[model samples]
Target: MAPGVNDAIRQLILNGRLNATSVMMPAAYIGADEVDALEMLNAGTTRAAIGLHVTLTAPFKPMSNGFAPLRGGAFPPINDMMRLAMTRRLDIELLTIEIATQLQAFLSAFGHMPDFVDGHQHVHLLPQVRNAFLRVVSEIAPNAWVRQCGRVRAGRALHDPKSLVLDVLSLGFKSQAARHGLTTNPAFAGAYAFTPKARFSRIFPRFLRGLPDGGLIMCHPGFVDSALQSLDPVTTLREHEFAFFNSDAFLHVLAESGVTLAQPSGEARGAA
Candidate 1:
């Protein structure tokens, strides 16, 4: 998640300072670098889990060897896709092709299915995208894991999400996960915008407290590189994410909250 310095992010996670990461797929990727990184991380048998940051937006380069037909030589911009999703005119066929292609590319590089799957803009929860993504994943890798967008209330510091259209769409996707016997977090953390001045230890506890036990905690940690900054304006945010998640404060939160980062024995994950 670094500003093009993918290695920095991987190093921290491997050193046991961070426990989770997501990958940008078929976008600005130097084909197979992700696989190399994933394999290297998994070799340590670290608790760190890697999921696809399924890319459909972000003005960046698709892996030179990617599987999508870029419209006008760039991604169908994120906003455009949102408009299409809203207008019911998105290119579902290409969406399916892109997801399937990214998954295959990831497997080719890692030699296994991804640890989990999500999306760059929560697009996987959209209708045509969800149906298409589920179909591709279930068809190609039925045993693979997928992330579900689960939100539950502990208190009201975080505003409750109130988009009925989004919820209805996500519910259908959640049901699809159940139908396929996939696992998801019992609750999700509110993704705050990144702040450069933040300390990892200080910021993580509140997020930890907000989470219900056993669901996945998503964090983006990366190196800040000029290339990455050019592509991802929020590179500094993830640097803070890396610093915070790796901080002693986060571990203290885990201990105090009795939150287990990974389930023992690979059993079903749920709220405590």
Candidate 2:
């Protein structure tokens, strides 16, 4: 959520290399410049889809009050939040209120509903949290689709622990969305070890191996700055991803993989 990252995404949008991005409504670094850039791009003929990136973890403060579990006005870490969600210990009322607040913030800033909705760190797929998230989206932005991080096919990255965990958590998520009268992506990819030595160029093609049409592939392509380094451990890889996506190699890979970037469409209430 740093300015550098925003710049990278803006460039990607301008170059037609990126089709969609979710904005973190509560990020402190988001200012008028970033909003103006997004507004210009969104209002222009660019096909970029902007959505809300619901955040409920550390390094960001909560938007709603009465979160008894918060620590020092900040949301808990991802692991702790996961435990509470899985065990159904989270206060659903407070979580729902916070999500709605974030959605309102997005609407106030953009003057329109998000094109889609997803969570920061995939929190929208978790247990108690999912119930609250889907309900809020259905109520506040029924036209927006939600992200479902479940894989549709086995591939080289199938064994990756992070992918497996997301798969498990995403089981029945689409059905849940449907019950809420929402739509979700058919499949998902783009999980990898964010290690310093990891080469995004080499790992990205694996995400395309079996991705279905309208599938969603998440990526974090950004530039590193003091703010980014202070808030996240995934610094260098962002630059690596940005380089790959901004390079001819990315075009070659997409051509070789027989892939095309298209905006996902649906008429159902709350489709992604």
Candidate 3:
């Protein structure tokens, strides 16, 4: 996705079709045109929170130069880090350097501090990542909010096996965030495993009804242009996601469900 797609999503959110968007900053589209993102933000044309969509994946391409500790020169870059971390192969110094690099990149690209922090593919929640992530969060803004995927309300039946993994990961994440004084949404969304062509109108609203106010909803919306596809494999399916999320149905459901849209405002949890 490029400036065109991001602008479209910003419009959709302004029109109240979607709630939030998590972006990959160093991934060209957002990074290539940080000025555009900042302009939209400064104008308040988009109200969704802009968090650090930390990239540890996409190895063959590293995003920044200043941050160290991450291993580059491989495909799906962060995969190496994850593999090492899981198998006890990660170097603590490298991990620290890489995260710091990402942080510096975010500030440079966006030209201000992030409103909250979350990982691309939930990387920030990983065991090794959580430790490094917190230190950065505490240092960067100290009071800016952070995101934890934990779902607090009980008695909800989780269907997918992947959800089970998320639940376990989120549990630990929530604890770490609090220890660092990072505020998080009571719920987090935006995990669509199936193809984006799959109908999301019903699915999205059901999830919205469950959305706790003063929380966050993560969404990936982009056109499946050839350029994007070459850069990222799932660009084809995510194109549908862009259109669907920006649709009239997406907005209607939220209204019907009485969901409120809010953006975090530093050290505060909002409901509206």
Top TM-score model: 2
**TM-score for each of the candidates:** 0.81, 0.95, 0.83
Cα lDDT computed for each candidate against the true fold: 0.63, 0.84, 0.63
- Cα lDDT over the full model 2: 0.84
**Backbone collision tally, model 3:** 10
TM-score of 1: 0.81
CA shift of 4, model 3, Å: 5.2
Please report how far candidate 1 places residue 238 from its true position, in Å: 1.6
Candidate 3 C-alpha error for residue 137, in Å = 1.0
**Tens-place lDDT digits, model 2, residues 1-272:** 88878888989888888888889988987666777888787563745888899999988888887765887789998999988888889989999999999999998887888889999989888998999999999999998988888876655354589988888888867888899888888888888888877989998888887877787789999999998988888898999999999999999999999998885232322211
- Model 3, global lDDT: 0.63
Could you give the C-alpha RMSD of every candidate to the true structure, in order shown?
3.7, 2.0, 3.2
Q: What ordering of candidates by TM-score runs from best to worst?
A: 2, 3, 1
- 114: Cα error in model 2, Å: 0.2
